[model samples]
Target: MQSNFSYQTHDYFNFVFTDDGSVGLYNNIVGDIYHSKFGARTEAEEKFIKPLNFHKNFFKKKELNVLDICYGIGYNTKAFLNKILKLKYKGKVSIDILEYDKNLVLISPFINDSYFKTSPDISYILINLLMDEIFNNKEEVMEILYKSDNKKFIEPFYRRLIKKYEKTEYSYNPVSQNKAFLHNIYYHYISQRKKRYLKLPKIENFYVRTYFDDARASIKSLNKEYDIIFLDAFTPAKLPTLWSLDFFEELFKHSSEDCLLVTYSNSAAVRHAMIEAGYFVGKIFDNKKHPCGTIASKNKLLIENKLDEYDLGLLKTSAGVYYKDSGLKNSSQEILEEYSQRRKLLNLESSSQYIKRNKRS
Candidate 1:
C-alpha cells in the first residue's frame, strides 16, 4: 500500500503507517482499519457514506452473503457489519476477509486514532497475536470459522457465536457510551457480528454475496449469481482489472434472473463495460456530482432507480475510466481506447437527439 493518500473533499491528514508495517487505522483497542479520513465515531453516527450505508433497506438479512474484496484492515467490513446490525435480521450472513498481507493487519493497531482504538478484545488479540506471531513467530491466527469445534474459543473468546440460525440477535448492538461496553461492541462487531457464516451461503435467488478480491477469481463463484452486488473496489484508476467488462460478464454469467450491481462510481468506461458485459446498465440516485450512477443487470426491470433525465453533455464528458474488456480477456490501453471510440461514435449519433435533465433539480 502507498504510504500516503489525501481525501478528495478535505485537507484532513492521516499517517497510515505503523512501526510494524501494518495497513490499518490506529489508536483503537479492537483494531479496526480506519474506514475513511473521518475515523470511527463520526462515520458510525453518520452511517458511513450516507448513500451507500442505506442500501440494506433494499436487501434482506442473512439472505445476502457479502464479499469484501479488498478487506484491507477491515474498515469497510466493520462499517458493513454496523449497517446490518441495524437491520436486525437473521439469515446466513458471511463475510470473508482476504488478508493477503497480514503484516499490515498486525501493525495496524498502534497507528493512532485507528477504529479499533477503543475495543478491549482487539487490544487482547493484538497483544496475544503479537506474542504468538510477532515475537514467537507462530501462525496461531487461523480462520475462526474453521475452528468452531472449540465453542468457547469461537464464541466468547473470539466472538464467533454460531447459533442454529440467523436472527437480529446476531447483531452486536452497542448498549452504552461506557468505554468498556464500547470496546466489546467494537470487537463483537468485527468477529462476533454474524448470523450464520457457518458455511458459505449457497448462491441463490434470495442471497447476494460481496466479492472482495480480484473480480476474475470472484467471477467463478457466480455459479450462483446475485440479486444485488455491492460492486466496490478501489476506483479503477488504481486497479483497472477489477473494472473491466470481462470481469463484469463473469458476474453476469451466473447472475440471478434479476441482478443489480450497485457501485458508487458513474464512470463512463465502467458504464460501457457493463453494457459490453451483457448487462443493461442504468443510472442510480445521483443528484448531480455524478450525472448518473450504475445499476447493471441482465434484467432491465431489476434497476431500482433509472436516469430518465439526461444532460446531453454527459454523453461525452470524461467520466472516470471504465473497465471495457467484456470477457475474461487481458485488458490493455488499446482495448480501452477502442471502447472509447465506440462511446464517441454513439454520442455523435445521439447529438441530434434531444433529452431532458431532471427539471426539478
Candidate 2:
C-alpha cells in the first residue's frame, strides 16, 4: 500500500551506500544489485582502469577517445578521468558515453563527492550543486521532472559550462590548484555538428557527448574512432542488447586500430562475441578476484596475456553460444528464447566436461 511518494522514495532507497561510500543500486525488478557488493569504485579501478594500460598508451596518442557503455553512475568514466588527470596528458581526450536509464542520470547530480570516497580525485562538486538547485523547490521539480526532463534542465547547463570554458588552456602537467582541472560532465543522444560533440568544461582539450539511446542503435551511428572502450553494461544474460555480436561489430568498426575495450565480465559468451566480431581477446587480472574480466583489441600486440588454450576451450561449449538480438531489435525474452533454441541444436559440452578437459590439458 505504498503511495506515489513512497514509490519515489523507494526508488532513491534502492541505492544503498557501500563501505567505500560509493552507492550501489538494487534493481527491484531484477532482484539484484546493480554493482558489486564488494565495492563499486573498487571494481571500476581494478577491473577497467588498471587493465587499460592508460599510462603507457595515453602518451603515445595525440588524442584519446573513449566510449563508456551503459555508463551507470559514471564510475568507469570518472575512473578514466582520474587516471589521465594524474598523468597530466595534454592531448585532446574525448568520451562518448551511453546510458539508457534517465533516472540514473537524474540521480547522478545528487550523489555528492563523499559518495566517491574511494576515488577522492573525482569530485562531483559542480554536478551536485546544480542538482541541488534543480530540486530546490523539491515538489515542483519532482512533479514536473520525468524521463524527458533531461533536455530542459540537464542539457542546457552542460552546454553553458562547455561554452564558458571552451577557450581555456592548460599545461600538460597543471598544478592541482586550478579548479578548472576538477571535472566537467556532458552527455547527449544525437550527432550534432559532426557527432553531437561537446567539449568538456574546465579541463583543457577534453570533450564528452552522451547518448541516451540504447547502445545497439546509438553505437552504430558513431563514426569516430575510440582508444579505450569500457563495456560496463549489465550482465549479458540480463542485458543482451549491448553484448550481442551485432553490437560488438559496431564497436569494432568505430574503434581505432589499437583501441582496447575492457569489461568486468569473464563471461564466455562475451568473449565469444568479441572474438567473432574480429578482435584479439584477453583476461583482466585482479588480485582480489579470479581473472575477473575480458579485454579486446584490434591489434594483437595490445592484448597482453590473451586467453590461454583452456579458457579458449570454454567458448566451444554451451557457455560460448552467446546471445543475439536478431538484427539488434529483439526483446530480452526474444533473445533468450532464440539462444535457448540455438543451445538445443548443439551438443555442447557440459561445464564439468569442459573443466575436466581443461585440467587435463
Candidate 3:
C-alpha cells in the first residue's frame, strides 16, 4: 500500500501532457507512454466506449459488469462514466479492475485535466477507490488531493476549458450545453462550494473493486462473468503474455455470451490468438472511421465488422503467429523467445509476401 516514488520529484510518475491536454505517464522501462499522444480521453472514448454502443445494448440491462485489464490511470473507465452520465443511465454498474502497479491507482486522481475536471463522477469513484483500497482514512486521501500540487497541475487545462466555454453560447440541449455544463462544474469546484457542488447521489449505483496484482492471476480468481471487458495492455511485442492464446481462452470463459472484449491493439498476432480462443473477432474503427483496434465476442452477431479477405489472409503470415503461455506462468522474455522459435519452425509466408501475392491476384 506504500509507494516509494514521489510525484513531486517526478521520480516514477513521469507526466507528459498529451495533444488533447490530458496527462499521460511515460514508462521509462517500457520505452513507451501509458496513453496515446493523439489524446488520452479521446482514445478511451473512441476505442473503448464508442464501440460498445452502451445506449443500444448494455443500458437495457438491470446491472452491468465490466472487467478492465491494465487499468493505468483509468482513462478508459473515466470515459465510460462520462458517457453513461451523459446518457442518464440508471443501471447499476460493477467494475473489476486489475492493475499490477498500485502507484498508478494512487496517482490517478491527482492527474487532472479539463476532460476529467468536467466529470465529477470520475473523481467520486476514484476517491472512493483510493480510500477503500489504498488508504484507511479520509484524512490521508484529503491531504493528498488538496495538499499535493493537484491545483497547479490542473489550472492551465481548466483555464483553457473556461476560455472555450466563454466563446460559445449556452444552450439547453445536452450536446450543446456540454462546454457550458463543464464550465459550471469547474467553477463550483474552484469556488470551494463543496456542499452545493458535490453530487454523491448520482454515483450511488456505481461499484468498483480494484485488484493490485498480476492480471494473469487476478483473472483466474474472478468468478463473475462480465458484459464488457477492456484489455488495454501494452503491445504484443512488448508484453505478449496477456495476448497469448491461453490468456484469451481464460477471458473467453469469463465473458458473458454477448460480451465484447475490446483493446486498442490491431496486431495480427493478437487477433489470431482471439480467433483461436473460440471467439468471433472484428475490427474497431477510430474517430475517423478507420480500423484501429480489434474486438472479440462469443456472439458473432455482436461483431459489426467481421474480418475481410485481406485480414483473414494476413492471419496466415508470420505476423499471425501468436505468443503462447500454456500455464500463464511464462515471463515476457520466455514468451517472445518461444514465439520466435515457433515462427521459424512454421515457415509461414511473411506478411509482405502475402500482401505482394494479393496484389498480383
Best by TM-score: 3
Query: With candidate 1 superimposed using the best TM-score fit, by how many Å does residue 192's alpha carbon deviate from the native?
Result: 17
Residue 324, candidate 3: C-alpha displacement in angstroms = 0.4
Question: For candidate 2, lDDT tens digit of each residue in 1-361?
Answer: 1111123432432556655656666677656677787777677888999988887766768788989887766778777777776676668877786776544644454343243323333434324323333333334334323324233422333344333333342331232312333243223322132364643434446666767677777776788888889998778887676788878888999989989999989999899999999999999889865798999999999989789887888899989898876677777777788888998898699767889877897
Q: 1-361, model 1: which lDDT tens digit per residue?
A: 1211222311121234433322324323213333434343333223222344345444553365444444444444445544444454345554433333444343323223233433423333333323323222222233222234422312242232212111222243332222233334444455544532222112222221233334565456445545445555555654465677667767677565655566656666677667767887666553344433466667776555554435224434444234565444444455557657865665543333322333334
- Each candidate's lDDT (Cα)? 0.43, 0.67, 0.77
Better of 1 and 2 by TM-score: 2
TM-score of each: 0.50, 0.75, 0.83
TM-score of 1: 0.50
- How far does residue 181 in candidate 3 sit from its true spot (Å)? 25
As for candidate 3, its clashing pairs are none
User: Candidate 3 on 57-163: residue-level lDDT in tens?
Assistant: 78888889999999988888888888888887888999898987765765565566445546665655565545444333323333433444444554444334433
Look at candidate 2 and give me any clashing residue pairs: 187-210, 188-210, 192-196
Candidate with maximal lDDT: 3
